[model samples]
Target: ESTGRPLVILDLALTRDVDETVRALPGVVHLDLPGVRDAVPDAEVRQVDAARAIIDAEADDFERTLAGRSMDSLITALRSHIGRVVMEEIERLRPLQSRLPASAVPSVDGRADARVVAGGGVIRANGSSGAIAVSVAAPETTSEAAAKVSSEAADEPVITLAQAERALHHLAARLLHQPTVMARRAGQEGREDAYRQALELVLGPDSVGGTHD
Candidate 1:
């Protein structure tokens, strides 16, 4: 989460308008960078990529340097900076993160992440859990049943994004198993009886009876 460069510590010794400079660069905030620390009012640029080279070299000088008095005289290591960065990113992702697939959905412990799918009309993601379990009785030749379901769902009230996601998962699973079930039952001896049984498997006795003419 702390993958982005959040801190922008300006060298008051070499640059002026630290805040303005930071604002010029996208996503650069003075909040991450501590108060400025400078040895000289302004140091002229002697070469190119000097800052990059120093960062690449990874040589630390804080141990050797003692406390100083300047507008940039802040200490105690920028420990909280990284944390602040991560929190900011998490906040950015919270809104749509729940809609993401289970693989990409991270376990957001504190925030209002969809960590669990509550039963019935509610939706949630089981805290860091695998795919949601869906069941269907749309046996042998689900084309008619699936088509009917789709048609009816189209007329229903607008569902929340979470509900739509759950519906998608269920529809995908139902379609996947449709062929397998049809193949197994295709070779059955009785034609009319088999068709009736399959229809019953799909809609159950109550549904079939309710639809009778």
Candidate 2:
């Protein structure tokens, strides 16, 4: 009676019988053993569909999480590689800057930068943000000024901005070449753990996962 518009009563045993007058009530359904057996398959199908939908949703969420982790790991690795390259180059050039005459070293008031944007496009060595952006705050002379100094002061040891850019580019390229290729393959192959492990191994454990923006 409480089953909404139509009350359904299932009697799997034929021992107890339903009253004739009670069965006569409007919007009342009485199903015997045969009728109940006939409904089982349809009910089972509906339940199976619901369970499958839930499983699919959970699987999709898990996959997306793994993908996100892999991407984060890759970015962290790239940034770490870029930062190290920038620092090494800066240190290497510092001695040259100090030894040269003040006029030979042109001062610049900005940090060196590199970035990686969406789509994980080709890695850029320039100190700018793209698919991944890496900026380290170090006040230094511009590469262009250093280049001019090289030409004007031939006797002195000097490095230009172009050289620095190239150096950064080359170093980054070397470090990223294998990782980039493998990372893409990992994503395609659903090997997230392997990719993360590789990145951590190559870039250090600190590069496990990090956010740029």
Model 1 ranges with Cα > 4 A deviation: 1-121, 131-163, 166-172, 175-180, 187-192, 205-213
Model 2 C-alpha lDDT versus the unseen true structure: 0.55
**lDDT for residue 212 in candidate 1, whole number 0-100:** 28
Flag clash pairs in model 1: 35-72, 36-72, 37-72, 115-125, 116-124, 116-125, 116-126, 117-124, 117-125
Q: Which model scores highest in TM-score? A: 2
**TM-score against native, each model:** 0.22, 0.36
Q: What digit string (tens of lDDT, one per residue) describes model 1 on residues 1-213?
A: 565877555444344545556666665655322343222234533333577678655543332121111101111111123234435544443443344344332333343224222111223334344334433332323344334334433332223344434444454455535533442344232232354355557645432233222
